[model samples]
Target: MLHAVIMAGGTGTRFWPASRAASPKQLLPLVGKSTMIRQTYERLEGLVPPEQTLIVTNQQLVEPIAEQIPELPVSQLVGEPCKRDTAPCIGLAALLVSRKDPDATMLVMPADHVIRSRNHFQSAVKQAVEMVGKSQAEIVTFGIKPTYPAEIFGYIHRGAAIDTRGDSAPSYVVKHFREKPNASTAAEYVSSGDYFWNSGIFIWKAKTILDALAAQQPEMLEHLKKIVDAWGTDKQDEVLEKEFTAIEGISIDYAVMEHAKNVAVIVAPYDWDDLGSWLSLARLLGTDRDENTIVGKHLGMNTKGTIIRSTDDHLVVTLGLKDCLVVHTPDATLVANKNDEESIRNIVKLLEQRGMTEYL
Candidate 1:
């Protein structure tokens, strides 16, 4: 059987004020009518039922996530005591799903991405499942065709094409993985046309990932095993808080995928967006005639290429501002240049350093 594991533990610090510590971007209804996590789960309707789905998030967010995704039983919502990045997160989920069915194929994805065309997304998943079914050792991941030079996302350098059974979608043997590159390197990669933005979406058999972790990351796997052993015990929380936070925080790419021999990339046939930062709002929600993406009450005189998000009660007025980002929450309002989106993380750090965590 196939299982869906949604990784929803991220704090989304870049989208601060609205995306706070307790309620992150995945919990918010940033994209559409439903929350981002709900949108992600709906994309797996026919492919994987709610019963087989699992959501891994921060312990504090467990109840909030349960409210939005009521279809999944509360038990299926796994809460991590602390942030250990994706490696430990996925490793834990793999063990839990594998316990039910040793032959389980798990579809792991983030909760904060905006992906249209569920059919196409599910189709790619099905194709990856097929690819995995044929050879369970082959770890399958999706590669979104980069429309531009993106400095934010990691890049996947795809190698020679692989046999996709019948070539439903383009499949390739994995070559190399590049971390977030500089603007010049990103442009060079884009010009080469062999790179795709690492979608961070992966599909593999439970045994496959566990085995890979055992090989490439034995020490971390041992700690994860201890956590798994304490899964149902009274000391579950105590051990998770201790072991998970102590584990080396690294992504799956560094922990396994980059070194795994049998890896493949399937060029996704769906429209995918990570919605990583505040600038992403302008991309997801288009701009008006003034080229400003306004979410709520906003009256701009010459705010072009600016992203404004406010509430119904507050009306933010901007004049003579271009390529700026203005987000108005009842508690905090963000005003910064859109081009300096990366500095949002610094602002969050500053807030944390100032001990003004009330705004975080």
Candidate 2:
């Protein structure tokens, strides 16, 4: 059997006022009418039922996420007391799943990403789950063939091909996991057909991952075990808050998968995007002849290769603006050169520094 865990704890600082502390990007509808998390959950419609799926998000977002994904019982929406990254989140999820079904295959993914072709995505997921089911110890992850040299995403090196299922996508033993590279390095990685942009979607057995966590992240695993022990008790919230915050914050790649043996990668069949920033809308919403992508009311005289987001009531007009990002919100508006997209994080930090809590 398979269980799903959706990691939706990200603050999404890059999205600014639209994606504030109360409502993050996952809760907001970025790609389509539905929220990102809702889209992700819907993508798993026939594959994994709501009863077998859970969401791990911020403690403050529990109510919002529950509201958006009402099919999931509030108990299944596990909220972290603080930010502890993916390792502890997955570890705790695996522990809880293993307690129910030790042989369960776990499908873990971020709630903010977009994956089209629901059938193809489900097929790929089934292939991954089947592969992991065979070995039980194999940690399987999906890898997207990079369209361009992406400096932002981690890369995975593929080894010899492993699984074959009636002309399905190839699965390979992952050779190495590489960090985000520089422009030159990224170009080199793209040139070499052996590397893939790590998609962050993973499938593995609950017990196997728990064992890996125990071996590689023992202290973290102990904390997770203690938290799980107190899951249904009166001390559930208190124990989770104390132990989870104390547990070290580390990515699954850094803490376990990078060191674990029998790790495999499945070249994904469906289109994918992480939607890291407002700039991502260019890829999703597409652009005009001038290469300007607009989601709402925008009138640009000379705007080319820019991304604009504004509602009907708040029309954004730009003159002589080329390759810029304009996001209009009721309280705060963001205007920046699209080339400096990474600096969006700086704006969030600056707001915090200036004690502008309302904007954050």
TM-score (all chains, Cα) for each model: 0.96, 0.98
lDDT of 1 by residue, 284-306 (tens): 88878888898989888967988
Each prediction's RMSD to truth = 1.5, 1.1
Expressed as tens digits, the lDDT of each residue in 1-360 for candidate 2 is 899999999999989868999998999988889999999999899998887898999899999888887888887889899998899999999988888888788999999998999999999999888887778338889999999999989999999988486678988889999999999999999999999999999998888888888889999998988999999999999999899989979999899877888888989999999999887899888899999999888788977888889887777888888999888889998989988988989999999999998999
Candidate 1 TM-score versus the reference: 0.96
**C-alpha lDDT of residue 339 in model 2:** 87
Top model by TM-score, which number? Answer: 2
| Cα lDDT computed for each candidate against the true fold | 0.89, 0.90
The per-residue C-alpha lDDT of model 1 at residue 345 equals 88
